[model samples]
Target: MKAETDFDKAEKLYNQKKYSEAKVLFESFLKENPNNYKSIEYLGDIAGHQKDWNEAIKEYKILKNQFPKTANYWYKYGGALGMKAKSVNKFKALGMIDEIESSFLMASKLDLKHIDSRWALVMLYIELPGIVGGSESKAIKYSNELMNLSKVDGYLSKGFIDEYFKRFTKAEMNYKAAHEIGNSKITFQKLYNLYLNKIKDKFKAQKLKEQFEK
Candidate 1:
């Protein structure tokens, strides 16, 4: 009970944006409950938010191993692996990407509601170098599927809907939906403009016209 209380306090601190203090408390909590999956998950989250992808991968992997049946654990493990892959060499990144896809696929199989896995897979396909794993067509297909699915409520759906799929006209439409939903103006603007930027291909006239036509 005390441990749970401490964990709650640390979580509250994290929510309040007191990262350093939250880290300290979470660390203290983990000293007594080293295998607590939730604590491990939160540690991974804090590390990710700090851009400490290696640490995030470690903690999330531990949680995934400890809780194999939990789709959330695998999804987070894949997400951390994806982030960590960015800093590794190409061969190593490909290996990590494989791990990421495998883990996310497992998560998706366990729970179709695991939208984060879907988004992560699409992101990996889109962002990877062509020689590594990139495929624009695959990215577009996954993104479209995710967009359609995002209309229903669940983890990552709202952000994926507004940020990933909302291209040009769709984005303009979502901007209105975001506002109606009382989403932060700054967040909505970032999503709206970011999508426009992506579809525009550096505002290349031919590319913009082509995508606009699509």
Candidate 2:
């Protein structure tokens, strides 16, 4: 009961964004209950919020090993690895790419409906060089998979890929499709950027900007 009360207090502190204070409590709780998954997960989240990617990776890796069936554990592990790779030297980043991809893949396999894992995989495939496992085809494949799961996300992902490749017209079409499906802030921002920067249409860009501002 004392441990539970302490954990609840730590969670409240975390939710209040008092990360340092929460970290101390969480660490104390974990010392008493080393196998408490929630405490480990929160510790990983706290490290992520602090941008201590290496520490986050360590915590998430432990979670993944201890709870191999939990999709979220693998997803968090992959995400931390991806962030750590981005923060490191180029040579080191190159070596970490495969591990990151594998972790994301494992997460996706563990839960077919895991949208975040699929989205991360799509971005990884799109961003990496061909020599290092980047494949536009794979990106498109994942985008299609997202389309099957969530229409809005699918269109947005496809639009992002198109814009990345400078296929402005196709990007506009996909972005418009996404906007029609759901006029979300992200959709509006993408359209605004497309009109303002890519198409150089100030009128359309201003309209979208105003809509988004509201």
Q: TM-score for every candidate vs. truth?
A: 0.69, 0.94
Best by lDDT: 2
Per-residue lDDT tens digits of candidate 2, residues 52-163? Answer: 9989999999999988998989999999999989899999999898889999999989998889998998899999999988999999988998999999999999999999
Worst 10 residues of 2 by lDDT: 1-10
Error of 2 at 119 (Å): 0.5
Question: What TM-score, to 2 decimals, does candidate 1 have?
Answer: 0.69
Q: What is the C-alpha local distance difference test score of candidate 1? A: 0.69
Candidate 1 residues lying further than 4 Å off, grouped into runs, are: 1-4, 152-214
For 92-166, candidate 1 gives per-residue lDDT tens digits of 877777788888789977886667777777777766777866776666665566656664222223343445444
Error of 2 at 38 (Å): 0.4
In candidate 2, position 119 carries an lDDT of 94
